[model samples]
Each structure stands twice: as C-alpha cells, then as structure tokens.
Target chain A: MNVPAATRAIVVARIRKLWPVLLVSVAAALFFGWLYQNAIAGRQAGGEVNLGAPDAWLLLPTLFTTAIAVAVAFACTSHANRDPFALVEDAAPLFGRERARANAIIPVTIALAAAAAQYAGARLSPHYATPPTFFLFNAIAAIAAMLVALSIPLRDGAARILYALLACGSTLICTVVALAVIGFTNGVAAAKAGLAYYPNFNDLWGGVAEASFAALIGFIALRQYGEALARYDPLPPANE
Target chain B: MAILEMRRASFARGRTNIVAPISLQLEEGGTLHWRCELAQAGRVLARMAAGIVKCTAGSVFIGDYDPKIQPVQVKRLVGFIPHPPPSNPFDSPQAYFAYRSDLWNLQCASAVERGMRIFLALHAQPPNLALAVSGALLHEPKLLVAENLEAELFDELANLRGAAALFATR
Candidate 1:
C-alpha cells in the first residue's frame, strides 16, 4: 500500500478509538465555560461587577486548553510507547521518521484547535480584547505541552523524569517572569487601565516568557525525537 | 551469500550487558535455534536479528545491510514474530494482516494468499497465533526470526528452512 493509504488507515483507526476521549474533553471545556458564565452572572446580579482586568477571562480558558492539550499529548505518547504492538509496528518497513511525524499529527491538531477556540472565546468575553501576543503565547504553550507529552513515551526512567522537569520548570519560570514584568513593573494602576488600550505590559511580557519557554521545550523535544529516530531500536535488549 | 550475520555483537541495557560478544552467521536456507533458559535473552536476540535493536558492540547485518545504519532496508529482508504475539485487541486477525501487508508494501493479493496458506498450515493452533505467523510471512521475507517457537509451530517453520534462513530463540 502507498504511504498515504497506510497513514490514512492508521489515523482512521486511532480516531475511531480516541473519539470518545475527544468528545469528553470537549464536553469538559463546555462545562467549564458554562460554570464561568454562571459565576459572572451571579456576581452581576448582586450589583457592581469589576470587569477591568482581563485575568479572569484568560485564566479558565488557558487552564482548560493546557489541560486538554496535555491530556491528548500524554494519551498519544503513552499509547505509542506502551502498546503491546509496538514491536510489530516498529519492525514494519514503513516504521521510520515518517511514522513518527504521522503519529504527531493528531495531538498537534487537537492542541492547536483547542488553543484557537480558547483564544476566540477569550476575545469575545466582555472584559478583554485578548491581545494577539497573548493568543500566540497561549498557542505556543499548548503546543509545548503537546511536545512534552509526546516525548514521554520516547524516554524512560531518568530521561523521562528530566524532560518532565524541564517542561514544568520552564513553564514555571515563564509564569514568574510574566508576573514580575506585569505585576511589578506596571503595578495596579496599569491593570486598572482597562482592556480598550494595548495589553498590559505584564501580559505582553508573559506572552514573551511563555513563547520563549515553549520554543525551548519544543526545540529540545524535537531534537530528542530526531535522535531517537536515528537510534530507532524499539525493542529492548535481553537484560533490559 | 549469508542472509544474516553478526560479528562479535554485544547488547547492553542500561549498565547491564545482556548479549555478550558473540559471533554467528546464517547463510540463505540455513537455520539457527538459539536455545536458552533465559527468555529475555531469546527476545533480545530475536530483536537484534530483526534490526529492531542495535548491537551495543560490534555489528549486525541483514543481507549485507547494517541494521543500525540501514534499518529500513534490513527490516525489509527479515520477518520477526516476537513472543507473546504483540496482541492488539482492537484489531482482528484479517485487519492486522492487511495493515502488516500495507506496511511492508506487499501486493495485497499475494499477501492474502500467503497468509491463508500459513493459517491453514497451522490450523490446529490458536487462531490469533496462526494469524501472527501469517502476518510475519506476508512479506515473504528472506530471513525469519521467531522468538519462543512452540512445539506445534516447529514443523511448519521448519518447512521454510529450505527456502528462507530461519532463526528461532527459546
């Protein structure tokens, strides 16, 4: 069979198996959105509602997108790494660099889609214009999460642990940098400056930090993946 | 010409040496039954022969192609049926064989014919195991490396000994 045909078969099979999980994730996102709207509605009924900061609009959506992206990545990596059929699949003539690329498509697609939806949702919210930089940052972060998740199945023990730490550490550093730049540099006065103006300095800095971290993690994962492909021995040695 | 050759090949997992330096060669239409009590060792050997695992030291070649350096070419020349049958509950035997045929770029008609022949030859064995054997044979590989061959399948595999180099580990 042709590469395209085989890839289609594999992808179709995977989607058939994964559709339920994907549906559940979508439902979860919708549920979270509903809860957020409900909370806002309740607050508004009581009287004065402060919608100055875009933080509230950004927080839940970002969390949901990241959570979903991470989940998809983990699922895909774990399936590829731990499947009993891994040896059989790896031994096939078609199993090579192309297969790895093909395997990444689903997770990457889902992640980017979720990020886009989150961005659109945030933009439509009453409190924020949702800066382009912020949107780009969130998209990168989601992609990074997917990459990290993809790497999990490729390595084990210390290597896996190290990658996990790198992902978490980088994201944490980005958050801190974003907070320091936005919270410390601009202070409360800038935050209260409203959403009509250019994004708060902190949001832009946060975007920069997140994008840099994402790029770092993405670069490392891709390099590792390439090396793994070069080494490309799926089965373990006798003792191991 | 030798279909499979290993030159003082050694394999390590982490700090432990699994396959100590060993040299062996199997020519076309030759058979090697590497019997060992250590099932893991058998598995490692099968994987090495199939180009699924690189030898930590020395070299391994399948039909003159280095498994480590030219894995795709080497894999095309070898068929590996690993122990425990790499089960995928979601796939039926037919579907699995079809997928394998596609991966190996085999002609669908010939693959199906060969698969059926193998299945019939192992009629008494479990259906899944029979299917697995047929799947391995779909490519009509020049070398067959099977791990943990059962007593029943021995005769069937031995029949291929005259045509394709056979390597079995148990």
Candidate 2:
C-alpha cells in the first residue's frame, strides 16, 4: 500500500486496539479533576471569587492530581504498544520509522483528548478562578507524561517500580515548572513592588512560550522513539 | 538465481548461539525443508530466513536485497507463517482479510475475496492456521517461510507454482 494508506491502516488498528484503555484514561483524568475540585472546596467560603491569582498551596492538588492521572493513563499505552503480533508487522514492507509514527498518533491523540477532558472537569469547580491558559499547562503535563511512559523498557524485572519512579520524577519537575510559570505570569515582580495586587495575568506570550517548549520536547522524544524502533528486535536470540 | 539465500547466517545471544551458523539457498519454485535439533532453533532460523530477525553473523538475502541493510525490500518479497498459529483477533474472515489488504496495500475488496477463497479451501485445517496462510498469501509474496507447519499445508503451497518455500521443522 501507499504510505498514506498504510499509515491510515496502522492508525486504525492502533485505535481499535486502544480505544478501551483510552476511554479509561479520560475517565481517570476527569476523576482526578473532580478530586482537585473537592480538595480546595473549603477556600470558596461562599464569596465572590477573585480571577486574579490562586494561592500556590491551592494549585498543589490540581497539579498533583492531573499529573498522576496523565502518568497512569500513558503507562497503559506503553503496555498496549507491545502487541504479541508485532513480529508479523516487523516482517512487513514498511519502514520502522513509518510504523512508529503511525503507532504514536493514537497515544498522542488520547493524551490531548484526556488532558482536555480533565481541564473541562476541573473547570466545573467554584473554588478557584480558571484561567484561559490553564489548559495549556495541562497539555504540557500530559505530553510529558507520555514521553516518560514511552521511555520505559518493556519486560524488565523492575519495570513497575521503575515506571513509578519515573512517573513521580517527571511529575515533580513539571509541578515545579508549572508553579514557576504561574508565578512569573501572575506578575511576581509587580506583586513584590506593591503596585497591583494581581495584575490581569492573561498572558498570551507566556502561553506561547510554554506551548513551544512542550512541542520541542515532544518532537525530540518522538524522533528518538522512531530511531529506537528502527533497530528494535522483537525476538532476540535465546540465551541457551 | 536464488530467491532466498543464507550464507552461514546464525543468531546468538551473548556467548550462546540459539540457531547455529547454517547456510542454504532456495531458488524460484524451489523448496527447502530444514529440520533442526530443537524447536526453538528451527523457529529462530525461519525468522532469520524470513528477514523478521537479523542474523548475528553472516548474512541472508531475499531476491537481491540483503535483510540486514534492506529489511523493507527483503520483507516485500517474503511471507512468513509462524508455528502454533497466531490467535485471530478479527471478528470475521473478511475483517482479517481487509486488515491484511490494508497493511500490504493490495486491492481491498479483491484481496478479501481471494483470502476468503483460500481460507475456504483449507476448511479441514485449523482456523488460525488457515487464516494465517490466507493473510500471508494476500500480497502474493515471492517466498513463503513456514515454521513447523503441517505437511498438508505444503501440498497446498506447492500448488502455487512460481513461488519458493522454506519449511523449518524440529
């Protein structure tokens, strides 16, 4: 088949194999969003909520819940990618890079979709003001989670333990970056100067910067994955 | 000219050889029934010959393409049917055939029709094996490699003139 046709086929097959798990991921993300809403429910105090800035402590639950949901969701994708019939595909007249790219479409789509779902779910909470750029941060975390998930080696003795460590490590880094970005965008300098309490933090430029950074990381990760697929041996020689 | 050739091709994991260095050739319309000392060894050797796994030493070629350097080209000319028959994930034969057609870039409807025809002809055979063989033949590959398949299947493959086959057995 032509490249486009073959790519379509691969994508269709992956979707067929992964729809159930993808659905589960979306549900899990939404569930986490619900938990975030409940975590900060006490801060509302039945008063008009300020749209300027949420306290760093209040954002903790959002970050942790979203990050954990994204990580677990993507880990399931890693398992699905290791199909037993992969040997059949390996012998096909398709480039490994092409196959990898095709295979990635579904996972990436699920990541974005699930992230959006979480954002939607979190938006329902009356505890905090939801910024328009909040979805962008969630998107970054979701992609990061996917990258960490795919980096895990399959069939290793301590794979589950390693997955947990990597998930936590990546989430921690993202959480720090997210907090810093929030501080910078919310006018940390302006707040310190005692000028405006919380200057309208609608930061288009900051959002663009965050998105560009995430896209760069995702591109590099996908390229590395494709190269690895090209040299992968589905059936290594037996030790005996 | 040989359609498939292995010059001392072997597979090794670290210091141990799984499929010992072996050489063989199969020309157009030829057949090679290679019997190995162990089932695992036969399985690995067949995969090497089919270009699904690279040989640790020496080389294997399909037509004029070296599997090590031109895996896609080699695979384009080869079809592999594994032993124990792969499980059928499709709900029906049509689904399976359509999937094969899409994967191989064949005429979708016609490929499905042809696959159904072949699948029906082997009605007495196990469903998984029949389905696998039908899928393997969908693209009309130049070479067919069977891993520990039954003899009756070979009778059917032999009837497909102009194609070469390699049957690996324990």
Choose the strongest candidate by TM-score: 2
Model 2 CAPRI quality: acceptable
Cα lDDT tens digits, model 1, B1-170, are: 99989999988877977777778999898888877667776778888988888899999889999987788899888888767665554555666666677667777667767777777877876776676677777787899889877654666787843477888887
Angstrom error at residue A239, model 2 = 12
lDDT of 2 at B74: 83
List the DockQ of the predictions in order.
0.52, 0.47
Q: Mark the regions of model 1 whose C-alpha exceeds 4 Å error after superposition.
A: A1-3, A36-60, A76-84, A113-140, A165-220, A236-240, B88-91, B160-162
**Interface RMSD, all models, one decimal each?**
2.8, 2.8
**Cα deviation of B26, candidate 1, in Å:** 1.0
Clashing pairs in 1: A182-A202
**Candidates' lDDT values, in order?**
0.66, 0.66
The C-alpha local distance difference test score for the whole of candidate 2 amounts to 0.66
Q: Using DockQ as the measure, which candidate wins?
A: 1
TM-score of each: 0.77, 0.82
DockQ of 2: 0.47
Residue A139, model 1: lDDT of: 64
